[model samples]
Target: MKSFVFRQFEIRQSADVFRVGTDGVLLGSLADIRNARKVLEVGTGTGLISLMLAQRNPKAEFLGLDINQEAVELTRLNFESSPFHSRLKNIHQDFKTFDTQDKFDAIVTNPPYFEASGSEKDKIARQTVELNFRELISKSSELLSEQGVFSLIIPAESGNDFMKMAQENHLFLIRQIHIKGIEGSKNKRLILEFSLTEKALEESEFIIEKSPRQYSDPYLELTKEFHVFKNRS
Candidate 1:
């Protein structure tokens, strides 16, 4: 697919990089960006999440970083074509080695969760060969401002371990939502938000579909601002 049209912006995905998916969309739409003046997105594949955040927070400046040159180019193109281009920037750099004196008010990512199990492209895009959960949490802790928030969506199976690692780094979980494919399906993904300050964890569940090819009401309502669907009544 060359491009995908959202309610506010159109994303160009001509480059052979990780394309936008449900996980990215969910994280982008659900992540809290209130009072965020500056935001950083690690592994910003095609800059989908950053673009969404830009649309949501017009005053916020965004920087999207990715190790893959192709992904960087694609994100740059996407950012440039959007209305919030002036507020957005895309850089070709690994998050681990990316040096910046500035800290962000919010850091978001949908990282590679699986261990290597697919093609070269898949491995680079889906596996944690470059940045694992531990390093990701540690780096976010270092680069985030005192009141900054870090948000991500990961596999449900790894949720407990990820929370443990985050706690070890003093990044306390503030909110979380478990995602299921259907009403009765197993939880597949977990969307979590963390902050440096300790707080009570708020938990919830999100179901994507009520039936085959039919979106659940909650999912539709949550994403109604961005996505246009048929028979959403």
Candidate 2:
């Protein structure tokens, strides 16, 4: 297990299914949140995305949901200890089963995508987090307010499939940022922002590092607000 302490939040994670990784960070930073007034984080592992959303939109309120009891407790503790505690709340329940009368201006998730072939841990994690593309899109569409955005990160291979599902559910791709570990490498992550309104926007790519030891300028600039040494060479 390893932990990362950022200026505003902390992640205690394992190589296990629930670990918080760079993909989540990329999605949280890439999400266009300046206009969001209310946010929902569907699978807030350690409350990282919720905290990031709160950091960027100080006036916004965040609701973080997770099915795992440990994760829920940890997120609650993390939120209370954080400087933005007043703006964040955590719910310990499966998103599918949780009932909320409110609609959010933004919904963000770092969805679990690996189809479980075997292993108990993998199976449980997938069941709790990963969802079929159709179900995810339809359910998210049901939850999102009209003209609201659904932002998420998932495996790059699933991008087009998820986008098709999103389209069928009346969600339009507003912005997309593909991410790779370094130059000329295969893209591993897709950060997506979808809206009900059809609006023209730019599409781009983000390389996290130029090489193993060198962080990309775009990555640093996007995350500099919360990650210390983000701009340091």
Candidate 3:
């Protein structure tokens, strides 16, 4: 298990169930949720994004779904123990199989990106529960209401493929934020927001750090609530 103790919340997550990482935090902070009423978090492994959104948007109701029973249980516990408990609900089910009559105002997810470097012994639940980039985009297109937004954090290398899939799904890119870990390091993640309404795409780059263990102000501002290191500086 991995433990993350933030200033306002504590998260206990499994190593296999896509541990709450920098990508998740980036997506949560950068996603636009000003007018969101109902939000869906697909594959909410530890309810990290759900909880974050709940705190960020007090008026929004969040529904988090996960394929693994253990993960759902963990998320439930986390929600109950969190300050945003009233706004959060966790369900144990796969996003593809979960039935919903109502469409959401916003959908956010930190999906699993299967890399060749992962080991076979890695938790099967994590690998199997993840929806591919194409799957997430297409599914979000179906579940999001008109003018609704879908925000996602994925490997930077896969941004082109994801954008293509979004276009194929009739979802237009509203914003794209390329995230780099450090000054000289390769871009590691991409934070994207999509909607049905066609609009000029807004793009920007975010560097997480200046050097090893030296975080940038933007990174610190976005992650101040979750990273202890951000507060220590």
Candidate 4:
């Protein structure tokens, strides 16, 4: 697998772990972490999102968790190699049973949403076999500080259900970004931010591309600090 090179750090990928992708990039770029002093990433595939978040918020410390042993090792390597390594840590543990006394100011994840079993390469990292929406929401609410935010990128179709589940757990929707793969296409993904406190909701839309192969200006600008593109002046 090719390593994803960011301006200040590089994400080393592994075939056994979920590769860095658009969803993780978007979460890392767009997740609300400005006020966060401690952040927890639920499904740290390659530690890409946490690395991006750490780079974005210099004062934030990060802890990543993964159930898969391979992913844990992979994230460890990526975190140790990053410039913000001193503030990053990861563990191999299933989030459901993982206990901690520390509360996080931000909990971010690019979670696997597939409910049906698929014969995919990284099935555990790509399916909800181990962790379901209900468990994730309940656990996040417990782990978050009073003013903490929980953020993630998942299928747009699942947004309503996720928000509802979050609400049941006392996590209210605060921000939502409807994401389209291309102009004129339906919103396929959603970036959601929730908090324990009820506040005014922030909503927006993002288009990844204007055409099939061309990136939109908004997408480019949002990721300009991280992605190293070719043929740029």
TM-score for each candidate, following the candidate numbering: 0.96, 0.90, 0.91, 0.97
The 10 consecutive residues of candidate 2 with the worst lDDT sum are: 122-131
Deviation (Å) of 166 in candidate 1: 0.6
Tens-place lDDT per residue, model 1, 86-155, is 9999888988988989989999999999886656765667998999999999999999888889999999
Off by over 4 Å in 2: 1-3, 12-17, 121-130, 230-233
lDDT of each: 0.90, 0.79, 0.83, 0.92
Give the per-residue lDDT of model 3 (tens digit) for 1-233: 65888777889887656677777788878888889999999878788888888878999999998877878888998899999898899888877777878899999987777643456644433343356677778788999989899998888888898899899999999999888899877888899999999988999999998888888988887877666773353
Question: Where in model 3 is the C-alpha error above 4 Å?
Answer: 115-118, 121-130, 230-233
TM-score, structure 1 vs. true:
0.96
- What clash count goes with each model? 0, 0, 0, 0
- Identify the superior model by lDDT, candidate 2 or candidate 3: 3
In candidate 3, which residue pairs clash? Answer: none
lDDT of 2 by residue, 26-138 (tens): 77777877888888888776788888778888899998887777778778877887888999998887777667788888988887677756666645445433555566677
What shift in Å separates residue 52 of candidate 4 from its native position after superposition?
0.2
Best by lDDT: 4
Q: What is the Å distance of residue 134 in model 4 from its true position? A: 0.4
Weakest 10 consecutive residues, lDDT, candidate 4?
Answer: 116-125
RMSD values for the candidates in order, in angstroms, are 1.4, 2.3, 2.2, 1.1
**Candidate no. 2 TM-score:** 0.90
Query: In model 1, how large is the Cα lDDT of residue 219?
Result: 89
Best by TM-score: 4
